[model samples]
Target: MPRAAIEANERMNLRVAAQQKATLMRAAALVHADLTEFVTRAALREAEAVIKSAERIEVSERDFLRILELLDNPPPPNEKLRAAIAALPRDR
Candidate 1:
């Protein structure tokens, strides 16, 4: 979501070294945003990127092909799988 579109109703407090605060303030000014807005946007963006990276899967071409082959030619059900399927409700 865009920073301007966020319905901010909570408060967050942060403390930084003087030089760091000055740098943040200058950067915020350069972007025509307040310190809180700039920091919130940056932090949210990074947090989203971290989450997205965690949820993504990267497999080599060989692994991908193996997965596709398994799907296309799945093995027959084992005894346990057959028992589990037999136990399912049959009302449908």
Candidate 2:
């Protein structure tokens, strides 16, 4: 979505060292971007990366094969499992 189309009613404040602020300003100028735009993009990129890392599951190759094997040849349901299945609504 274009920036103009989005409502900007929220505010975020940050504090940084003088040198860090100067560096950010210089980098923004070098890229011909507004400081807010550059910082927002960088922060958003990092946020997405952090979210992806947190949500993703990373299993070893051996564990992955074991998971697939269990799926393909699951054990027979025991008494508790059978009861749970029987409790489900049949009209679905």
Candidate 3:
């Protein structure tokens, strides 16, 4: 979604300690932004970072090679796995 669209239609309310509010206001001033804009931008940036970290998988080269090798030379399914597959419901 576009930033403008995201910002245009949302309302949020927050409460903070005086010191925290002062700090944020000061930082916002230094960046020449209103308090709401500064807080929104900072919150959005952190939110995106958190979501990206959660959604990403980081694998080392050795592990990647190992995964590929496993795929290429997979072991035969064991009895338990075969039983699980057999237990699965058939599609209509």
Candidate 4:
């Protein structure tokens, strides 16, 4: 199945000093890239790290079956889980 395009809900607006901007331009010049290309490449590298850290782990076939078995017969809720749930902030 194909997935539909999804728009992001958040945006960031960064501010920097003139000196910093000059330094960035110089670095971009050294790399023969425009400011937009340099900024995008740097942002994309950080974004890749963020995405890798946030993703769920893939399991082996045997481990996946074990996970399914656990889901079929889930353990009773522990006190720690109950406390954690209570401590969590309510979503709007």
Candidate 5:
């Protein structure tokens, strides 16, 4: 696909060594996707995991207590959070 085919999403080029490229190409072909599509999907999957891990979440005593409380008596819905989740992509 060309630049014009891509939507208004943030994008950039990435590089890997020649040997790595050859290895990835073989893997991609085995899975029935071209090099570009294979690499892009793999990289973005890892990027999402990294972003999730970077979120500020701690497992301290207070956090554990809050979790126990929630498990004991779950809270009602927050409309804002529900709307945010509903807006996410369903195509996976």
Candidate 6:
């Protein structure tokens, strides 16, 4: 089944050097895509990559093992944690 086309109602404007604009137009023509479509597709691809990289956390194998070990052999809560927990309101 064919999908319905989405309407483009928003606008974004930017200024670039004439050479840069020409280069983008040339690349778009080589790919048989309209200038707006090509630029937006490339921008969106890069944006998604940037967002994924920012949201990802990388841990070393040694640190990961340490985390698992800590979880398995957790320490007893000390005075501060006990006081904080006790300070919470109790139900009637």
Please report the candidate that would top TM-score against the real structure.
3
Clashing pairs in 2: none
Pick the winner on TM-score between candidates 2 and 5.
2
lDDT of 5 by residue, 1-92 (tens): 11236658766666789999899999999999998899889988997787777774669998899999999999886999899889999997
lDDT value, candidate 1, whole model: 0.91
What are the models' TM-scores? 0.63, 0.65, 0.78, 0.48, 0.51, 0.63
Q: What C-alpha lDDT do the candidate models reach, one value each?
A: 0.91, 0.91, 0.91, 0.85, 0.85, 0.90
Which of candidates 1 and 5 is the stronger one according to TM-score?
1
**What digit string (tens of lDDT, one per residue) describes model 4 on residues 62-83?**
9999999999999888999999
Candidate 6 residue-wise lDDT, 59-86, digit = tens: 9999999989999998899999999999
The backbone clash count of each candidate, in order, is 0, 0, 0, 0, 0, 0
TM-score, predicted candidate 4 vs. hidden true structure: 0.48
Per-residue error (Å), model 3, residue 50: 1.1
What C-alpha lDDT, on a 0 to 100 scale, does residue 77 get in candidate 5?
65
> Candidate 1 — which residues are off by over 4 angstroms?
1-9, 75-92
lDDT of 5 at 79: 98
Off by over 4 Å in 4: 1-13, 56-92
- For residues 22-45, write the lDDT of model 1, one tens digit per residue: 999999999999999999999999
Give the distance in Å from residue 64's predicted Cα in candidate 2 to where it truly belongs: 2.4
- lDDT by residue (tens digit), candidate 3, 7-89: 56568879999999999999999999999999999999998997788788789999999989999999999999999999999
Q: What is the lDDT of candidate 4?
A: 0.85
Q: Model 6: residues >4 Å from true position, as ranges?
A: 1-9, 78-92
